[model samples]
Target: MKVALVGNQNSGKTTLFNCLTGMNAKIGNWPGVTIERKTGTIKGTNYEIVDLPGIYSLSPYSTEEEIAREYIFKEKPDVIINIVDATAIERSLYLTTQLLELDTKVIVALNMADILEKKGIKIDEKNLEEELGTKVCKISALRETGINKLISEIKKGDKLKRKPIYDVEIEYLISTIQGILHSSDSKIRHSRFLSVKLIEEDERFDKYQTQEIKHMTGLLAKKYDTDFEEIIATQRYNFIEKVREKTVIYKPVKDDLSDKLDKIFLNKWIAFPIFVVIMFLVYYLSVGIIGSNTVDMVSNIMDSFSEWVGNTLQSIGTSEVINSLVVDGIIAGVGAVLGFVPQLIILFLCIALLETTGYMSRIALLLDRVFRKIGLSGKSLIPFIVGSGCSVPGIMGTRIIENLDEREMTTMLTPFIPCSAKLPIIALFSGYFFKENSGLVSASLYFFAIAIIIISAYILSKLVFKNTSNTYISELPEYKLPNIKYIAKEVWDKVIAFIKRAGSVILICSIVIWFLLSFSFNFEYGVDIQDSMLASIGKSISWVFYPILGENNWGATVSAIQGLVAKEQVVSSMAVISGFSEEVGEGSQIFGNNTIFSSFTAASAYAFMIFNLFSAPCFGAIGAMKRELGSNKKLLKVVCFQTFLAWCLATVTYQIGSRIENGTLHLADILVIIAILLIIYLIVKNSINKKKDKCINCPYSDSCK
Candidate 1:
């Protein structure tokens, strides 16, 4: 037996899905999330519930709605749990009507009934069930209310059929449209629900449209002297109004905290400032104060373990090669990266709090004007904000943008924003090179990242997506105080995900990296890198980074080589090079004791940080970009552009710094000039190419052109 959960967006469908399945669940990319589908099973039941992506209607305007529609029509589940927002039944009923048309066995799970009661609105469940011809189950999915009864009903396998509730006028109109469609096109045959959809010019019904519907739609439009879609919309609302009159009762409203808070939070002038302070506080707690300290402590413990392992292996008479792989390459490479899990957990915690409390959406709304000026919708802000967490998920978040052009633009520029994984590298470089002003250095790097994104967006706007249209509309959910239990669960879930990922993918990749930097038959040395193949490869690639880093800097180059798999690996490789010593803290005197930066400024350490920070993201991010961008050509373009841009920024910074430090310009100054000119030329060329195509603002033209 199977059960399917369906609902409108933000109607608590997912909350119910989680509650029903408990820990017996799995989350993956659906069409909206990416990939194909995500499924989870109910524990100890023959019923395996599939949670359908949130959709407004089954007319299939978007991929998510199509996925939902296809699943219902194809798979034909034994029971359907239509999760509805009792408080927002007017909007919620749209999808419910479509579900009724499917003629499947269904029970209405009126979720968020608690919220409705607080709002002084009451739903007559028995009357609704009688009128709609289906069973009604009131549930507060989050609070575990009515779940047992819901489960019992599922087990009972009692099938209920609902005659779709429609007004008399809508019924006549739908009949007229259906007859017209069927008469006009023999090919287009569906239930009356689809006939109404055809009148609305739903593109999905085009394939099902017979010549009859086509001719009938034209005749009706001439008869009504209005577009058929507008006519259908009017009918839908008319039906909703009648149903709402009968089933809903509104009592005297009282002013609540939700309303009071909205006045302050949704205020145009004060909201952004408050939001900025909140964001600063979140980062301060995560990366600056408590979280960083926690991470540092964990890192110290891991470092000690690594040191003990190294010493024990040597004392046990193990070969140097074996000890190096186990201690230096694998442990050192992966541990340095994994050490930041605590910080990530704290950061995710703060974000989850903001999300749960419904503040994140407010920020998006507040920033809509600013975003719209750049030809982006408020939805684009969602991905941009998420980019700070990690570009992979950030880019994935672009799926929220209904407009294809806006989505592409968001995806292209998201990686330019510094993610959590890149934070350690920035901290290391800035702390080591610029004493006391570490926060300023970090903030400047972040600002620089934002600058790159804005400049790139502006440049691309003139070239790539010039013809694309932008329509911005986002619903703002009422603000509520966050639940403590929910916040804890959210934070814990994120932390566990990070730990699990580190243990699996990062650990395995670290081992591979260790092998690459460890194994080699060194015929010349009569051995390898301590007799390893990876050492030979690192040496071979060392020269490639020589101009910016140095030929003898095997460690830096090795870290860069490992950085392809994960950006944090660069720092891990550094720890390995520094001998995995627990004593080596952020401001280690031994390494900087002989550093060349204070004396000579050519390709200085500061410039190196800028380069690494701006360079192409890790392999995982690249793969995500490829999948989101949907083309290999676009992915390659992003990588090349990022590398080139990083080189220019680094070259210029080094040349300028060297001139200031040495009291004279060096020959490398000329290389810096040429690099800057090349970047400018590319930017101009992209703009010119877009202009030639008659596209005024191609938002992603920088890479596309």
Candidate 2:
């Protein structure tokens, strides 16, 4: 049997699905996280449950709503499990009434019923069932309470068919529309439901709008003396209000804990400061002194293991080439990335803990107030929050935003926030230069990213598109104690994903890097790295980043290019490149005593970090952008814009920071500045030419010209 789990956003539908299927369907306390469906088999049962995207009602005003409506219309499952948020049952039932019009069985799963008493809300389940004409099961998906009985109810078919909900006149009008549909179309799937959609003039059914149906709709509007859409919606809410009066009770009490805490977390003056402090502490613990110690311990273990293998190979009279391949190529490259596993573990744990405590929701609420000042609503923050995990889902999460321009802007901006893939880059630069103060450096980069995003949004709004006002309303989940098992699972999942990449993509890329570093164009083995094949290839295009890294720095140049595969490949490439060639000095690690990056100053290194952090993401994320934008023209434009902006920002940072901090200037900086200015002048010149052409075509051109 197939069951469809449907609900409003944040109503715990996905959570309940996780409980039934034992799958970690990504859960967020805000909207836009799960805008797509996820399916899993219920444990120990033949039932497959599909978790559909949340919608406020059947009306297709937004992308999520359209997805849900289309899924129900096409994939008619055996049962519809509507997971209603018990705390907001009145608001949730607006969708429930619409669901009943379909012939499918719907069992109302009243989630979060366990906490109703604490919030001074009382839900009489029996009364609710009687009023809605459906069976009600109270289950807390997070706590795993009352799930067994809910499953039993589904198995036993404990549900009631819904009765007509609206008044007699409204029902008569709906019946008339259904009769018209039946006469015009013999294959109507859900005549009752389609009739109502026709009455509302939903765009999806435009093809089925016969002249008779249009005439009937016009007559109904004249009879009602109000907008047909408004009257229909008002009547539905009126019925829901009557049900709430009979089924729900509110006891007089003080504000609940969530409301009380919101006062401080959402305060005007201190909210953003608190968020900054929380984020700083999270980074500090994950990348600073504590994180560095754990990473060092892991690095030492790998180092010792590699030494043992090398010694054993030598004692057995193994070929020098084979020994170098094993120790220098594979171990060095993969280990450089794996050593940072400890840091990722800590970082994922901190984020998971914050998410469980509902602090992430608070951060969104807090940021929404500030986002408005910059012309973006809180809806955009959801993508940025998810982007911190990885950019793919973050980019996909933008589908929930209704405005095309806002969604496009969110897509372009989501990647500016540092993702898990970029952690190795942050660790590499900060650990080498900042040392024990690495946590501060790592956290500063995060804030710097936010500044970049804010500035970019402002520029886009003023220069490119008109910004519209959008109010963000999210139902804040009540805070809870951290779930240890959930946090552990989340951390484990991310760590394993990182290791899998190291073993696969990073592993292959490392061997490729080793080969490039090992041979020159003449196929001479053991040649110096400067004369090697990799250097030849890097030098040809290394001029692109000359302003950021200075001239003749092909090692960093190739590393940056290799980052397109996986950001971790940047470090892995450098690790492989650092080991070979006597001219660069042999080093045990990328930042050891005789490091290959010795020529790098703090300013140049940081500028490089800024460039890589803001540049186009890995190919996986680019594919996501292509999928979301749905046009190669837009994708190419976005990628070029991102790369160009990153280059300009990195060049400017290098030119200013080097001159001020080092009291020196390179010829590359002057040339980069001139090139950037020239590009800007050309863009402006093209805009002027376009305007002149528009004027030449105008009817009033003679008066204006």
lDDT of 2 by residue, 35-137 (tens): 8888999998999999988998877666777888777878888888998989888889999988877777888999997788887888888888888888889
Q: Where does candidate 1 stray beyond 4 Å?
A: 24-36, 153-190, 201-203, 211-223, 291-303, 434-437, 483-486, 500-554, 580-591, 594-606, 653-705
lDDT of each: 0.68, 0.82
TM-score of candidate 2 on Cα atoms, chains taken together = 0.92
RMSD of 2: 3.9
lDDT tens string, model 1, 149-221?
Answer: 8888786654555564444555665687666656767655346767677667778668666666677667656
Please list the residue runs of candidate 2 whose C-alpha ends up more than 4 Å from where it truly belongs after superposition.
155-161, 183-187, 369-375, 465-471, 583-588, 592-595, 664-705
Clash pairs, model 2 backbone: none
- CA error at residue 337 for candidate 2, angstroms: 0.7
